[model samples]
Target: MELTRLKKKLVTAVKGHKLLKDKRDELMRQFLDLVRENMALRQKVEAGILSANKNFVIAKAGMSEQILNTALMSPKQEVYLEAGKKNVMSVDIPVFETKTRTADANDVYSYGFAFTSGDLDGAVKSLADILPDMLRLAEVEKSCQLMASEIEKTRRRVNALEHVIIPETQQNIKYITMKLDENERSTQIRLMKVKDMMLEEAHHYKEKEVMVE
Candidate 1:
């Protein structure tokens, strides 16, 4: 009976150890995936930032030139911004579209310039041109944040399984296995002693029968 109990305990411990190992492996996979995603997003964010900077420089130079030229020509113009929404990776970014109008209070100064004559136009155009970059940056930033959060959560889970939960379960399994082993040894010793006593008694009976004969 004791041997039977030990066998059952050993089986249970082996099963529990396998389950804990599987859980640890699964958590590690999840954590690795999140890390990969975070690295990709970071790369994209860097590229987008560089592109945004280049666009800003070009836009600044163009606007400066346009401002000087417009001032010299003394042309009057009005510009308005109409912005629309652009969705990138579930993040909505504003894309400003420009509308320019030229109005002459009197015919003293005739407006003979392109829609891209003024600083405001240049600024608006620059903004519109960089809208895609802005959107990319937003998407990358948000994705990075989300990935980082998920990675942290996954890491914690992995740590718990690897360091605390799995180890505790394995320790318990070891303890149970040891107990079962000890019980089995004790039972085997008891059985051997019982068999030896039975053999001695049988020999004594044979001796008595011989003496009577």
Candidate 2:
């Protein structure tokens, strides 16, 4: 009975190992895709920031520090960031949403046009345009990290089932089966010896009865 139970457990372990392996493979594939996307988005965000900084530098060079600081002192635009979760392959990844307080495209310009240079406007626009991409990059980066962690966990489970549980169960079943076969052979040998003794006694009794007659 114990052997039968172990065999059943072995079957279950094998199936679970296969499933975990499949999950790990799928996670790896998606992880790699996310990694690529993350790299691309990082590059895009970096480039956009660099360009925006260059615009800001040009704008600063053109105007006095006091005027530029005064112009940017008050910002009309307000950004709302909403963070949420998305499930993918059993991993909960982050989802980020961005919304502006006002729909007006010009709301990004905090200062009046009369006071601000065109270069400042260009810089602000650049930063505003890259906001969504930056959020997307963040989301993808977080997803990649989560999927990588899940993949590692799945891999460990698969390895444990494949290398440890199934093999031990099979070995145990083999040992039990060998011992049962030995016991059955011993019982058969003992039964044959008893049958021979009974036959010999019956022959001896018949001889004694004939002699008395």
Candidate 3:
């Protein structure tokens, strides 16, 4: 009975190990995809920021410091960001939405065109255009972190079952089965010797009866 139970446990451990391995593989695939996307998005965000910085530098060179500060002091536009979550393979991925307060394209510009240089306008436009991509980059980065953590946890569980639980259970079952077989052989040998002794005693008794007659 103990051997049977151990065999069942071994089967369960093997099956669980397989399932965890599959999950780990799928998680790895997803993680790699996220990593690729994160790389591309990081490049895009970096380029956009660089371009915006260059435009700002040109605009600053063309204007007085007081004028530049005044031009950017007041904001005509506002953005609302909403956050939510998406569940993927037991991981929660973040979803972000950006909503501009005003639909007017000109709302992004805080200063009148008469006071600001074209370079300032270009810089502002570049920032606005890259906003969504920046947010997306953040989302992808967070997802990658979360997925990586989950993958590690899954890997540990798989290793425990495959390397520890399953092997130990199998070894226990083999030990118990060998012992049971040895006990069965010993019992059979003892019974056979007892039967031979009984037959010899009966033959001796029969011979004595014949002599007495």
lDDT of 2 by residue, 1-213 (tens): 997898899889888988888889989989999999999999999999999999999999999999999988988899899999988889999999888999886679878878678999999999998988999998998898889889989988988888888889889999999999999999999999988899999999999999999
- lDDT for 127 in candidate 2 is 94
Candidate 1 worst ten-residue window by lDDT: 104-113
lDDT of each: 0.56, 0.90, 0.93
Q: After superposing candidate 1, which stretches have Cα over 4 Å from the reference?
A: 1-117
RMSD of each: 10.6, 1.8, 1.8
Q: Provide TM-scores for the models.
A: 0.51, 0.91, 0.91
Ranking of candidates on lDDT, top first: 3, 2, 1
Which residue pairs show backbone clashes in model 1?
none
**Which digits, one per residue and each the tens of the lDDT, describe model 1 over residues 6-47?**
556656655655664555455456446645764675566566
Give me candidate 2's TM-score against the actual structure.
0.91
Question: Which is the better candidate, 1 or 3, if ranked by TM-score?
Answer: 3
Model 3: per-residue Cα lDDT over 1-213, one tens digit each: 899889888888888999899999999999999999999999999999999999999999999999999999998889999999999888999999888998876679888889779999999999988888999999999999999999999999998998889889988998999999999999999999888899999999999999999
